[model samples]
Target chain A: MLKPEILDPQGQAVQRALPRLGFEGVSDVRQGKRFELEVDGPVDDAALARIHDLAESFLANTVIEDFTVKVEEMVGEEK
Target chain B: MLKPEILDPQGQAVQRALPRLGFEGVSDVRQGKRFELEVDGPVDDAALARIHDLAESFLANTVIEDFTVKVEEMVGEEK
Candidate 1:
């Protein structure tokens, strides 16, 4: 997940408008991008670290946004 | 988080192109919207349930996409 900085114009706009859309208790609404990745191998610690580096270097723009990388293990047998 | 169905054209396009951008191990890349909401009160169970309802009814378009809602409690003292 990547979110625009709080000072970002887009985020501010969404925050201001959420109350008008019936979200009365909602004070801030910051919209961003979500990237779901399906990896081919085991999601071990090393793999997670690699993905984190990839997210910082390639996936997200660090200038104005922040990102998070989550790794979920596959449930069934690996093929 | 809301993701498009596998048959979605936008998701397909992203999955097809991820490898080209050096995400060799990544088989699928599904893009979607991420919304961060800051509510005015405690993020309790009832607040979460209400947020879920709001997400389904207003934030996400259930016809073609699926959404997940996560609630994180605020850390600082409430004003």
Candidate 2:
């Protein structure tokens, strides 16, 4: 997601359009991109660190955006 | 995010490019949009229902994408 200080024109555009479309009560809106990565192996601390670096260097522009990495689910693992 | 049957070209592009960039072992990647909405009042079930409606009607293209709405964090609320 974009850092608080960065200008998110896309998010601002959405926020402005919402009230006009009858969706009220939302005071603010910020938009960002989300990615789900399926790893071929365990995501250990070292893998997380490398992923962080990858995010900074390739996925997101660190000059404007900040990102968080998380595990969503273990597919077909268990209930 | 896009439905499973939808062709996520953007996600596929990233997946294809990753191995070349030395970030290996990622088997798949899916991309989607995330929004952080700040509501002006307390978030109850009705609010959530309304937000879900908003997401379906405007936030995501229901023909290709499916959306889920959840409250992330409440500002000024006790942790």
Maximum-DockQ candidate: 2
Q: Over the stretch A1-79, how does candidate 2's per-residue lDDT look in tens digits?
A: 9888888888888889998999899888899998878888778988888888777788888888889898777547765
Q: Please provide TM-scores, in order, for all candidate models, with all chains considered together.
A: 0.78, 0.89
Which ranges of candidate 1 are over 4 A from the true structure? A1-6, A74-79, B1-14, B75-79
Per-residue lDDT of candidate 1, residues A24-77 (tens digit): 788777778877778877788877887787678766788767887876665474
| CAPRI verdict (incorrect, acceptable, medium, high) for model 1 | medium
C-alpha DockQ of every model: 0.76, 0.84
Lowest summed lDDT window (length 10), candidate 1 chain A: A1-10
**True lDDT of residue A7, candidate 2:** 82
Error in Å for residue A78 of model 2: 5.8
Off by over 4 Å in 2: A74-79, B74-79
DockQ, candidate no. 1: 0.76
